[model samples]
Target: MGLVAINLLGGVLASLAFAFVELRPSLPFLFLTTLLVGLILGGWAATSSPLAKLYGGALTTFLILFGTGLSPLPASTPESFSTRIGFVLFALAYTLCMTALLWRAGRAAENSRMA
Candidate 1:
């Protein structure tokens, strides 16, 4: 619950920042809000929901893209092959980082339990 609220706040702030910066005109920073919200919710749900917990990373990313697609952006932004590739690369990196951190934390907890 707390995480959800924090996520919401962060999403709103990022959205505002994008709007203030006028990112890409048609596709603004509101797109990031969806990604951030999805990541947070997916992560939280994955902790207790067996389905989400099993495929949290993929599900979270899909949700993000879906949310972005539903946004009121133009029919087509200034997207190109390179930009799309960059987005995928960044998403992969972000997911890997999150997974690594979670793995380390789990290991630390297990060690403490054994101790």
Candidate 2:
């Protein structure tokens, strides 16, 4: 639980920084941020279940990040609705993929150590 909370905090903070601070989110920026955050959050196998911590932390962080991205864009019309939803989906997918890769690598390392 503590590990999950800590990972969640770090991931969410990284996501928020991109959301609020970055005026224009480029591909490299998104990849680097997510990769770094995921590496830091996942590479530490403090608990027995690194997979649970990684997935839980990542899913929750992005869900919250999704809300942050969706909040300001009040999608009233069809075009805006699609745009907002698409943006949210695309960003979430891209970030999650990168994060998941790093997290999985960490989990594998933890497993190897246990064996």
Q: What's the number of clashes in each of the models?
A: 0, 0
Off by over 4 Å in 1: 1-79
lDDT of 2 at 41: 49
What's the residue-level lDDT of 67 in candidate 1? 44
TM-score of candidate 2 relative to the true fold:
0.35
User: lDDT for each of the candidates?
Assistant: 0.50, 0.55
Ten residues in a row with the worst lDDT in model 2? 76-85
RMSD in Å for model 1: 12.2
Q: Which one is best on TM-score?
A: 2
Query: Residue by residue across 22-85, what tens digits does model 1's lDDT show?
Result: 5444444545655665676567666766545434544444444444534456554234322433
TM-score of each: 0.33, 0.35
Off by over 4 Å in 2: 1-11, 19-24, 45-60, 63-115
Best by lDDT: 2
